[model samples]
Target chain A: MMEKVAQMIAVTGAQAVAHAMRQIEPDVVAAYPITPQTPIVEYFAKFVADGVVKTEMIPVESEHSAMSAVVGAAAAGARAMTATSANGLALMHEIVYIAASTRLPVVMPVVNRALSGPINIHCDHSDTMAERDSGWIQFYVEDAQEAYDLTILSVRLAEHEHVRLPVMVNQDGFIISHGVEPVSFLPDDVVKKFVGELKPIYPLLDTEHPVTYGPLDLYDYYFEHKRQQIEAMKNVEKVFPEVAQEFFKISGRKYSFVEPYKLDDAEHVMVALGSTNGTVKYTVDKMREEGCKVGLLKIWMFRPFPKDEIQRYLTGRKSVVVLDRSASFGAEAPLYEAVKSSLYESASRPLLSSFIYGLGGRGIAIEDVEEAFEKSISGELVTDYEYYLGLRE
Target chain B: MAEQKGWKDIPIGGTIVEAGSAREYKTGDWRVLRPVYDRSKCIDCMMCWFYCPDLAIIQEDAVMKGIDYYYCKGCGICASVCPKSAIEMKPETDFAEEG
Candidate 1:
């Protein structure tokens, strides 16, 4: 496959995602608008109206209906996609599990934002983190470029033969979704060939070969069916990097389940996900100049939790701190629990601690990360399970 | 009859093998009372056939034939919908003597 020279263009994460959707030109897009993610579907809707793509753009009444429509279309053997944010994603909660359990590979882009109570619209991982166990293959992107690339790759990964499960590409709400950055766009023909044609395993619409979905399963088979989903997610961990390698050939960029930065020979490490990695990189570099052995581990895919890769990176480190953007209330935050469990049996495990930061889009400065790393390395700090990094008093 | 499958052998996404497969699983065991039809008084109005929750009423070419007891949960919908009072609900134990 002869590749076209990728063109660099300035666009926000949402716009870049829409451009990828336009290029892929799926058969159906059923989505409702929400903060930060609204522009993604809005731009794709424009592409549909302008006849640039032949996708059937459904302006659904709600996020629940949007996911329901996508599930129906995908089961009928059509390539389908959607987009949503915090509250909208919460509304689609029930059907999200249906999409996974039914094994429909519907691709969606989720703009990460704080879940509402006092109603603040800003960047946080609360929404996607809350849905960790819903059984979807999840990917968190650091910036607009990664957001665009991963959005295109998710379609292929979701439709892969081994992993016929729904996929969500996540980017932080305003930090990445609304921020404009220079993104390298692949040619339409290249993306078309890369995604190829979706081959649905058992299409309900094929009258000649009919199949039923979402049937009642009592104790006789419910557990067995859930085991199938577990097997599918296991396939995701093996299949993700392979798809990324194929993507790396077309474009010059490579991606993995996790990205480790300056971990070698570092005594202290901070693990986080999404757009925070961009800031963490600068903080790590500055701390390195001062002779502090500090590093950062940026997690790209969260759902299958990538335990093996995490152990490989943090093996020799002295102290590790996990930064979570969402609170788990009565328990330690989600990422902290995952990291702790992964290292629980390792021979040379680091002293682990959890720090909850950026709730409701609270600012996390480099000093906060540096302070956490400093306290973690000092050995005088009490082994408190979890700390709120930037909370006032 | 549809070939029976173990829980593991069933299709991945709860797909039933054939259309209208409720016949394969005899649900009559769930019944405490069974519907008895007095066919001589039956008008063949087909109301019971249409309103049966179990679709247990056997009809051929719009003519009421009989009830398929295999799937009839004895819900008594046929007795309730029969305008002629031709269908009656009887205790399931009473049918043991006839069997």
Candidate 2:
């Protein structure tokens, strides 16, 4: 039974990421340490020490500097990247905006963790939620294989000239980030051939040429600056799948901006992102076996929010309940809002709903997901509504 | 399969090099490099004027400032280290080449 669960490799989650960092061969990785997330950076430091990877890894004063230094290195035309989670991601929030706004194609792994106002750090979307609008392409993974594969694919997708956007490949902090599973890492040549070379839109250090980046703006110029950022962001919808298609030819694990699991001919569905998608998918199958017409949506690309594909996936569906691990504070969950907007333009849109199920690393069991689906089907739960599913007394 | 070629091997024979590469400008060719100033955001800040690094920032009034990137490196330090996010970096794509 355990063998079918993917042979357990005698390696920690941090070591898995370390192995990935070596495979990606980033020219510069500058990351500081924190719980669970520390081992990833530490393992890369070990790679630099053991001469396992040919790269420059910087030890910075804080996560802010870690992000700041990578921005500087990437702007100077190096294949640069880093890693962080929760509070660390929040610390680098200012520069994360700069990295994407400047169009430096840096890729980083965000081990999902809860934010700290009350000091909790066990796999929540707070860290990622805070940075959702920061202009990076966010992807969530279900397991170590994805953590390994997406890390490689991220460099390719982020660096694609058409996209040229930073990407955050997130794995749930304790669940996937700390889990050990056998990952058949593609050979170095295969990854190199797949990811290809780095050609920045404008690299700063070229002696024969010079370019300006990350400009400031006033009201007169600010609007257009942001417009251009939007324009660059809008390009990703077409840009992502071309790279993904090529990656599919090699890796065999194909992905879209949003992944649809068993959605066809279905009347009920649950849209989810990140690792929980796996659990929900299994639950969907179980519910389907019980004669329920339900499906699952596993969203991989969170930014540039694959709106059209999302609605197209739901074209024939009857109802959708978005299961979000993060909340928008005083409003609907981000996933729920995105799903609503995607269906906004659809002619045959379904009754859509929002469920803010997980917060502060609290669990949203599969049973809760099934219960939400049952409620949506029988009209016991209103579609034009939001519910915090797992609130504890 | 997509073709992979180095920029060096691209043989870009007719690539247009910017005028800054050569020092000469034809009379009607050089587009005036504009220094967009922020009047409301400006605090009589000479930081842009003083730290022109290339001395591109000009002090028109006692407080108003400007940049002449005829020598500006596009380094953006003036706009970046600015007290307020005021000044901007725009490329002079139409600058005339001088030889």
Best candidate, lDDT: 1
Highest TM-score among the candidates is held by which one?
1
Query: Taking the tens digit of each residue's C-alpha lDDT, what string does model 2 give over A229-324?
Result: 576678878777887888778777787787788887779888887888888888888898998988988888888788888878886678888888
- For candidate 1, the TM-score of chain A alone versus the native chain A is 0.97
The lDDT values for all models are 0.88, 0.77
How far is A71's C-alpha from truth in model 2 (Å)? 0.7
Complex DockQ, candidate 2: 0.04
RMSD of each: 3.6, 11.0
Clashing pairs in 2: B24-B98, B24-B99, B25-B98, B69-B72
C-alpha RMSD in Å of predicted model 1 compared with the true structure: 3.6
